[model samples]
Target chain A: MSDIQTDLQAPLQTPAQPSEDSGLILPRRSFLRGAGTLTLSAAAVAMLAGCESAAAGTSASAADISILNTALGAELEAIAAYQVGAESGLLQKPVLDLAVQFQGHHKEHADVLAKTVRSLGGKPVDAKKAYDFPVDKLKSQNDVLGFAAGLEKGAVSAYLGAVPLFKNRDLAKAAASILGDEAMHWAVLRNALGQNPVPVAFVS
Target chain B: MSMRPIAADAIGGGPRKGAVHRAGAALRRLYALPLAAAVMVLVIPAEAAAAPDPARGQQIYDRCLACHAVENNRVGPRHCGLAGRQAGGLPGFDYSDAMRAAGFTWNRQTLDRFLADPLGVVPGTTMTYDGIKDDQERRDLVAYLLSLKPCAPR
Candidate 1:
């Protein structure tokens, strides 16, 4: 059977009997569970084509997985950071829209990274339910923008440090691509804060 | 028919100095072509060897966009004025001591060498980039950087 079929079979138990109450003869619980599994598989496949199943032996180096997970973690944090900024009520009009857009980018980065981790036969790290962002400090619009700018700057540095460390050149390229976006977000956020968008020549 | 004497000399050890001399001359003629080709290759101008493709360089510059910008400083310094600028010439951006002490101008040759190996050229430079390795890619990136108009001072 195909790998997707195998993945489906493992999660599926003995077929559930049809439910009598809801009129339809379908095995509702089992069908919904199976659909969820299929949806996840489809999402992973769509995110990265030609990914070997996680059950398969690791094709990527352990180092590559570690680097990817580190980047994924950063993306997750950025997503959370943006979400906080979005909900803070401090961002007005276009600034709020910009935060949501940047957040969406981080989500894309996270999805690709998580799928890449799975494709490499490694477990993708899960994001923590709660992040320790200094929400108490974010009282004003400038405070929120500064906080987000700091996170984007940190993400830029994280990706910069990661790009060269990957054993896989493709991974390095992916990291670099993400780095560019993070830099752009940082510049834009700084600009919104009435600060210099491009403040330095080099980032550490 | 002409080569038979040299072939015979390989098996028949009797000293035939004339045959040996003829064989040596033939070998010299065989080596001369490649030697001349090598010289021609060495002397080819950098531009003729590989014309810089600014377009391709722009694509490759995506990797650098994380920290650098053509018009304004991002994480890194702007590329405006990069062509003739000193390594650490930007006034406000903090440069690593190694970069400050690099004591080199940003010309094509210097940029090519530095892009190929940043840490090697400027050790302890704050830029974390590992450096572009492909010869053509590096050349293209340098071309793109050079193509940018120097940014007007703010």
Candidate 2:
């Protein structure tokens, strides 16, 4: 499942600046970094009806759970990103509706990923109190749209990179499904900004 | 249930060296894709270009299953009866004003354009999805949608 492992690990070249509270630098690189470091093998989950789990507290491999959590983390970041844009009051009416709707989608993604992690006997990752979004850079609606669009594109790439690495085919399939959604988000945001919605025939 | 903090520092700093290295290799691979696709296009069998395959469209439809279903709606309208049905015509399905007023019927041509660019076709529609970009994918997806027979009312 390392087919897109390298691709997923490719960090976007954004101006790196540390968040005041977390002291972590590179907002764009933060979420995208998780999928790149996964070295886990894809071992299938073996579930038993109602028994105490064996190794790792459950039938699912730690690696699979880790992958889901990593994806979950990215989804959380997306929700936060949209929240920043939505609350900025920069977007007008129609764009605001679109952001809210897209944020809802991310929330759905986060909820499903969290439930899946729990189903696998793994603790889901929590969203950070604040993410290292470039608030200073988001001065206008266009800027906010561009910022959100970048995150969506990164999400698409991250999921694209992750889909092949999942040990569970179902998880991979789920990730691909979300990947499509992210791609659509990217295209829509780009369209909103008056850019080519479908710039490339094939998504990278 | 208890939750753990994301290792922000670990993600932003430490492993990035290796990630940056891998990214270089990945970029090279990405750059080569066009050439590979070109070769693939040249070698694609003629039959491969035959009428859109509903089977393949069905696979592509997996992406849409998150928001839609053949029999019922989730985030979007129920897809059954999509073919030749009025745009936003489903009863009781709350559609965006843009969609409700789209005033068009779903057919091969209309579906193709809409699938290619939903917002472009109906700006302010709350679908919030980027239409399918690939021409063949849109056609196949339209084929799959058309193949679906209208399901019974819920």
Candidate 3:
């Protein structure tokens, strides 16, 4: 589902440089801006819908197929969320760069999952071009922080849920690896939002 | 067609003996095929017990040796004589509370599990290496680590 959304949003174009006050690199946003309009390609959207259907237990093979699709979707969502933060002029350059780097990692993970799915005789979902977020609803710094925290929490849950379902050892390891990064992100975001750096005696 | 005298003779006498012999031969062939299949299945090797080459293990250990040392402490602990040593027992080294509390004695099996997923095995331990996935390589690394004896006092 998220993979389909991201795939539809691929080849993001670079936009004109924002004013100095923007204080962000916003690579993904700039690229999207350059593209001028957000278009969710028909095929990509169809694939995303199919992924959602599979996730909803519509078919006999839904369990495995849906898990892969959901993993891809979550990675895409993470990338999109990071892009939004970068483009919003709310974060510093270092934080923006970190988000970009993390997005790249998520992309790599999505690609791995896609390949695994194809290898297992399943179709990979496409990522959407533009994810619909409640950007307007995020009225304050706390709002942004909460959004990021939620994203990380969702990512952790998604990865944890998918871990047991993965039959391949490499995939399992990859999930575990990314789960750590997600925890790191959660910590950073929480600290930025003025929360405890380590919550509940967990590393995150 | 109606049975003739020859058919009657075959059913009643000589030909019956030949039919019985043919049936026995067919039965023997059927049993032999599955017997050969079973033998093939048994002969295939089990994956886990294959011996690791120490030389290859040494090469893989190079990545680990950067943070660890054979003789003494570096960025991490001295890995010398690590096998069979109690984890967190290195005197004077500051270990994470989680690592100390784990109270594990480092052996091949425990080390393998720890290396495979450090945080998973010991929740609060601080060792961050992503772990060696290849079974042979891990075995070899363990062998190499075990081979390093503590240096004698000057």
Give the alpha carbon lDDT tens digit for every residue of A40-136 in model 3: 2334333433343333333324335544554665566556766776666554444456556656656665666576566555777576665556565
Best by DockQ: 1
For the candidates in turn, chain A alone yields TM-scores of 0.72, 0.71, 0.61
TM-score of each prediction = 0.44, 0.44, 0.38
lDDT of 1 by residue, A1-204 (tens): 133223433332222333445444323333333322321233433424333342134435765675566566556766777887787666665667777877877787788778788878788867766655556566666777777776677567557655665566656666666667777777666666555556678864
Q: Rank the candidates by lDDT, best first.
A: 1, 2, 3
lDDT of 1 by residue, B20-134 (tens): 4433433344345547867987888544447889998886665553345456443346677777886666776545454555555677876776666554454444453456777
Assign candidate 1 its CAPRI class.
Answer: incorrect
lDDT of 2 by residue, B60-85 (tens): 76555333446644334667667777
Model 3 lDDT tens row, B13-126: 011233444434433432454477569879986455567666776665544422343554432466666767766666655554545555456776666666555544544343
Spell out the clash pairs found in candidate 1: A201-B76, A201-B77, A202-B76, A202-B77, B67-B76
Stretch of 10 with least lDDT, candidate 1 chain A: A32-41
Give stretches of model 3 more than 4 Å off.
A1-62, A140-142, A202-204, B1-154
* Candidates 2 and 3 compared by DockQ, better number: 2
Q: Each candidate's fnat, in order?
A: 0.02, 0.00, 0.00
